[model samples]
Target: MNDSFTLGFGGGGFEAALRNWEPIISQTISFVPTLEGGLKGGMNQREIDRGVDGFKQLIESYFSNVALSENRFTRAVRFK
Candidate 1:
C-alpha cells in the first residue's frame, strides 16, 4: 500500500501525476473497511461517500495551486 501510494505520487509528471493521485487515494481508502469482513463487511456508505467528497476537495485545491503556479511562471516568462 505504501509503495502504491508512493508510486502514484511520483509516477507521472505534473498534471498526470496529480490525476493519478485521486484514484489511488480513493481505492486505498475504500479498501480499509474490507479487512474485517471481506469485501462487503466494513465502513458504511456514508463514511465512504464522505471520504470521496473530502478527496475531491483536496484534489481541487491541489489543481488550483498548480494552475496558479503555472500562470505565475507564464507571466514571468512573458515579462522577461
Candidate 2:
C-alpha cells in the first residue's frame, strides 16, 4: 500500500505561493520517498522539477492571456 502526497504549484508567483504552502509542501516531500514504488516510480527530483516547470509555463501563459484581456478592456474604456 502507498500512502503519500505530492505538492506542486504553477504560475509566476511560485516563491510567494511556496511561502504560504510550506507546511503542505514539506509533508509531501517527506512522504514521497516512502511510497510503495519509491523514486523508481517516477517520484524523483528530476520528475518533480519537470512537472514544476511544466506547470509554471502553463500558469505564465494563462497570466499572459489575462493581462492581454485586461489591456484591451482598459483601452476600450478609455476610447469610450
Candidate 3:
C-alpha cells in the first residue's frame, strides 16, 4: 500500500499541482496512482514519465480549462 502511494507520487505531479492551486492561479494539476497503478501490477519511473507526457498534451491543447483531467490516475494544472 505504501509503495503504491509512493509510486503514484513519483509518477505524477500531485504535490506540485497543489502548490499551483490558488485563488489567483485558479488552476491545478493532479496526479496520483491508485487501482490503475495496479493495472500492470506495478509501474516504473520511465513509464511514469512517459504517461506524464500524455497529460502535458492536454495542457497544451486546452489553455483556459486548465489541465483538469477526468483521469483517476492523473490530473494536470497549468499556469502562466
The TM-score leader among the candidates is 1
lDDT of 3 by residue, 1-80 (tens): 22433332323465654454442234324433322333353676666666666655544555435333433323333221
lDDT of 1 at 39: 26
Better of 2 and 3 by TM-score: 2
Using TM-score, rank the candidates from best to worst.
Answer: 1, 2, 3
Report lDDT (Cα) of residue 78, candidate 3. 25
Q: If scored against the real structure, what TM-score would every candidate get? A: 0.34, 0.34, 0.30
Candidate no. 3 TM-score: 0.30
- Write down the TM-score for model 1: 0.34
The weakest ten consecutive residues by lDDT in model 1 span 71-80
Q: For candidate 1, write residues 36-57 as lDDT tens digits.
A: 3322437667656666566566
lDDT of each: 0.47, 0.46, 0.42
User: Which digits, one per residue and each the tens of the lDDT, describe model 2 over residues 13-43?
Assistant: 6565555455434534543343333335567
lDDT of 2: 0.46
Q: Give the CA lDDT, 0 to 100, for residue 27 in model 1.
A: 40
Separate clash counts for every candidate? 0, 0, 4
Q: Candidate 1 or 2, higher TM-score?
A: 1
